[model samples]
Target: MLVVGAVVLAALMLPGVWHLLRHGLTIVHEAAHAGVAVLVGRRLSGIRVHSDTSGLTVSRGRARGPGMVATVAAGYPGPALLGAAAAWLLSRGYALGVLWLLLLVVVLVLLQIRNWYGLWAVLVSGVALVAVTLWAPAQVQTVVAAGLTWFFLLGAPRAVVEMQVQRRRVRRRGGRDESDAGLLAGLTHVPAIVWVGAFLAVCGVLLAAGGAWLLAAWPVTGITYPPWADVPTCDPMCPSAASATAPGLPFSVCDSEAVSTPPEIEPHSGRNESLSLRRALALLDVCARETDPTGLTAAEIGRRLGVHKSTVLRLAAPLLESELLRRDTTSGRFRLGPGALRLGHAYLSTLDVESVAAPSLDELARTTGCLTVLTVPDGLQSRIAGHRPAPGTAGRAVPRLPSVVPLHCTAPGKAILSVAGTALLERAVAGGLRPVTPRSITDPGELRAEVLRTRRRGFAVDDREFDPDVRAVAAPVLDHTGDVVAALAVVGPAARMSAAAVQEHARSVVLAARTVTRRLGGAGLGPSAAAGGAAEDLRARRGA
Candidate 1:
């Protein structure tokens, strides 16, 4: 159970996974708008679910009025509100209630679904919830509830990202304003980006509230509280409390602790207290990074968090007991515990990219006779999310697969970089292009020109820049809104994957990348598309 939470937690923290799981939130988002339209005395027209995970909720009402604004505003915040409700239910140990509510919502959505596909989607989702609620074991139901809660909490923001992306695309194409963010922009005379921020703020607040409640309701169980917890007025007993005599007081008092005032809260002005709390929360946030559990020592954590080593240990003590952090006995080092994995897994299970792209990537590997990897951007690098090994290549000595690849030296990274804007590209190489090999481009200007070349070519080639005597070719995987969300790469030895083989594999890699991109509800590389333009420019430049 703890491991599930930990996994979900880690997975939720990942932006890459969030895009993959944003579809579930889309259903709720449309449902929320429809529900509000009905509540506000508007006649429902219909709801349409698109292949791209975007949806439309139509209603008949005054062209411009409070009802219209309410309906438009409800769509974006719908998932967050629903998720907040679910979290509240989970925190209150009403997991069964959460399941039933989800079923009810799905049923309601099914009734309003306009098209056959939409009907099928909502019906299937609703029936699944019903089956689980009716036939699944109690523990299974609880897990489902937890998973649903985490999905709502984490997936809501990614949906917002999708909305923002859509908004940008629509602005670029001079298309109709259909997004909730776009609608809110017109309603309040605020920019769409600001509206996106408002939606994010709502989701963030709800997530924090729901997460806190759930944690308190079902926290790690092995930790024993100190005797001070038994003290009658020592609420949330202070970990740093010290004994001090009280002058002319009937009862004995510590420096800050009294029967009347809790020692856990220091006597400070409101602003000071708020600042202190923010700093403490910042420390907690530092320790909660997905990589921190297995990566950082206490001293390293303190340095990163900008606190003293003793202070870090002091603050981490309660978390350790809570099983949020586990200490390795031999090295006395700390890493995230099972709880983090639980959260990570919960978030990952909701995503279907691996299942969706497996066959395509496998085919690419077989066709190219090179290791095919599926990767997504991770800050200034690309992380391998999935891979397919080339045929009859299992027994050979291959390079170790990397969980993360640096942006400047890897084909997958360069492919993604090709589509990035100037500012983002600058940030990516801000740390300076470190040399992985003598051939690696260390100069920022050279790397920038290479990125532009990759953009023109609609793919990237890493010629032993990352690994000595190894070569790779990669293509970007676009999302529905034409955003480069991931990359597909074919990698092999420098000797065997010759210039001719590189050209051959590059075609197969580009085709495979487009296949996965289409499956993800994104645009294909056509004549008018930017990807197609790049390919055209590349061919013209090379006189191919």
Candidate 2:
């Protein structure tokens, strides 16, 4: 029983594995904020769980006070508290109760999720709980419960340690580190490091207490046999061999106490034959990359995995049965199956355009030292949702206005228009092709031609169209289905943004948009769409 928890605790140290696992902790973190906010009489605005495992809980109330402080401080301690509850339930021989509690927790969080990503995360977690509760064998349920308890109890302190590490790194770079500890420091006049130490101490105490409870709840005492493990074989020479081999034998008896002459389980023991989750994912990854119609053979897969071909097929059996991988009967080759597409669709459904585009938008602003913005089509017009200026030009270039501009004149608008369907295009042209500058395309026919050019180039150029002395270049942000969802643009003074400059900047904007597109689970602009633009003439700009 402890082995399961110990394995989960050890897995947390692996970076790749930690990425997916940390989201559960983040959910708990944000739930604590939401719960405390409600208890303090604050109106919970909503919660957003980002793709990167960060979360936000907003509540309407006084910005500062004991209530606000409590809400802010609740996040870091939430998982530990939950783990303690799970430990208590486990100690009482109520393992299934812990699983039910998890389901309840997810349902509550799902009710408050404001963004698609949060909703998807909560829903996925809820589905897993439901599956385990309704379908998993009793043994699997107990192991899962113990593992989850370990994850929460141990993951809390680990998160705090990482938070402190990120804080220090940000401070080293002269950036403001508004971590929970730092926020607490500001509110309570306590040093951030002191708050960090306090969080670590509390979590450590909880971990110690929870661990003891779990240990005491083992099968020898209050617990029973896992009820699913295969019957163990005992030494025939042993006097107590028959009783030791019996079902419902305590773990102590089977593990070491009663079985004095147990057989050894070596690294290659048949009893230890199992495919780990990480290895399964690795197999799927390599198979997914096989573009050939028949896919890679088992021998090739084994070569890539650095294992024997027979071992490959043995390990792949579960994957084939689960429908996550499809094997060709005739050629004995393998490829990703429909089940993988379902997983991909699930991931794509969780993506948010703004959150996905934010990093590239910020990087573009920093790289070009110009005004970079993300725009989406609002009816026939283009709306500027957000903007960032170059490093030294924070308040310059563009006002912090969430303003809409004419689709025919602005770079972002034209970029979006380039790929828009006939209905949207006709509606946009019906808006009179309004001119914002002397050089703007006002005639509907001329505007249609310009959009065609933008389509071929994979980017749009304003060229003093939006403003008399301003030039901008933009590219469309597409989704997994190749539909434009938004546009990315960079604007600068016409003097510094000559035709050559526009060409250079256009490539950067196009590549940035494509990067954001892929990150958002988009298929990206195909070779034909990016041929002359992103491929041949890479856009780049340096703000002056």
Candidate 3:
């Protein structure tokens, strides 16, 4: 198995065999140029991917502006940078996020693919990713991600070599130079060789950094072993605070003098340093969750985070001064402020999931005469990222739903939860299911069974479980890494969303989910036959 894996990895790295994979890198390369152009306020005209592993991203902006320079510089380093980013996300357990990001990039690029071949290439690749994301197991997703990272890291430098050859050819032919390196050289008054060197430097650094990160992320146990087998190692000799300090000491050791011990082996100090950083990050997360109309006070924040009010105050002080959080003078309550809004906007602006799914959502809402909603997973819960109302529904009564919904009750919530592993599900329901209605599944075992049923059926149903009158059916949206990033649901009143209506709407909802998944670059539909079973499921449910 190891030898086979080595062979596969080596094949993916070799340029001769690697051309089979170069299309993806080419798309990323062109997308990087377009992304940078748009980020700098340039108008992206279109993108063209050629059969020769080259692509062009055309943008309109100031002729001699920084945007042009950045766009020119982006092409050669794009794939390497993207691969490094994927490695970084994987290292931090953001594999699904990376997949969704890549899928978004591809979908964005597809909108501008100027040729039939380019469209075909992108569509096929996207479909493949969707299939893997929706059907493949988590381990397969990891391998697919790692393979992509390796291909990009190893393939980028070779492309630089090709650029150098192209430069020489252009010189011999006295042809108008067109390669990205040549264009960059012309723009910067730098030699083509120098541009090539810069490309090499960037690709080389990414290769080394990404490789090291992937190695570190690799488990000590064999790949076949479950992730639980790879236990986190901790320092056995690290002394507890109670054991390290004298038994009769009255004063707390949290003071500055606590570090008066020998510097050579202050394990307690090292732990404190680590804890300080972790506590700050945890405090930020706790505060970010305070989107409630009534902001949380220090006392409430401390209680929720399992810390003392003094500790919460101390931790919040830096955030308050940084303006990442706001405090109400009258009530001493804290909420996310302008700085957090800026951060949220920055992230949302880059995430193309909402943009890609909007059209499908509109169509689904129109076709079903039901409410269409997109929900993205946020920690243990799911948040309504986008909402679409049915056509010609103005002035009609609509069901009100919370922006944040627990993973146990709603259709969209359960759809996302179904894709999460048992460990994550357990963690999500640890506080127990909050009943939104009398029919809500509060028992952990029952909820687990329901999630499993959702997995089997490829859709989740909330038949007045979340709200007494609201009914919904949701399908999980998978990204390129086979992780469920979001859910798409069609919701309506229980009277209209009868068993037959659910069966009918369920098809459209699942299809919309699949469309979003494909747009994001997930592809394997044949193996699962998710849609093929839709009719059969509807028949069964209607009979019941």
Model 3 lDDT per residue over 1-544, tens place: 1332366468866767767677888898899899999999999999998888778788898887678899889988998998898877765444555667678888999999998778988998888878766676545666676666677777788778878888788889989878887777788889877888999999999988987776654431112121111111111112232233211111111111121122244345648665555555666666654548668888887766556789788878888888888899998888887887787667545657788889989999999998899999998889999988877879986667689888899899888876655556767678678888976889776676566556555567886788877778898887755677889999887766643467567667876887787667553232233333333434433443
Models 1 onward score TM values of 0.39, 0.42, 0.41
lDDT of 1: 0.69
Q: Write one digit per residue (lDDT tens) for candidate 1, span 1-544.
A: 3455577767766866654455567789899999989999999998988756778888998876888888888876787788778877765446678889998888888888898767867777888898988787545677787788777776777678777887788889999877877777787788878888988898888878777766644421111111111111111123333342222111222222211122244456556545444444445445554344355677876665555678667767766676667778878777776765675567546646666678878898888877889898888888899997778877886657979989988999998887755555678767788999976878776676677666644568887789977888898887655778888899888768743577567657766776677666554433245444345435433541
- lDDT of all the models against the reference? 0.69, 0.75, 0.71
**lDDT (C-alpha) at residue 463 in model 3:** 63
Candidate 3 is scored at a TM of 0.41
Global fold similarity of model 1 (TM-score):
0.39
Clashes of each: 26, 4, 11
Counting only residues 3 or more apart in sequence or on different chains, how many pairs clash (N, Cα, C under 3 Å) in candidate 2?
Answer: 4
Writing each residue's lDDT as its tens digit, candidate 2 over 451-506 gives: 65566546677767778777788988888777889999998887676434554566
Q: Rank the candidates by TM-score, best first.
A: 2, 3, 1
The alpha-carbon lDDT assigned to residue 351 of candidate 3 equals 55
RMSD, one per candidate, in order: 26.4, 28.9, 26.4
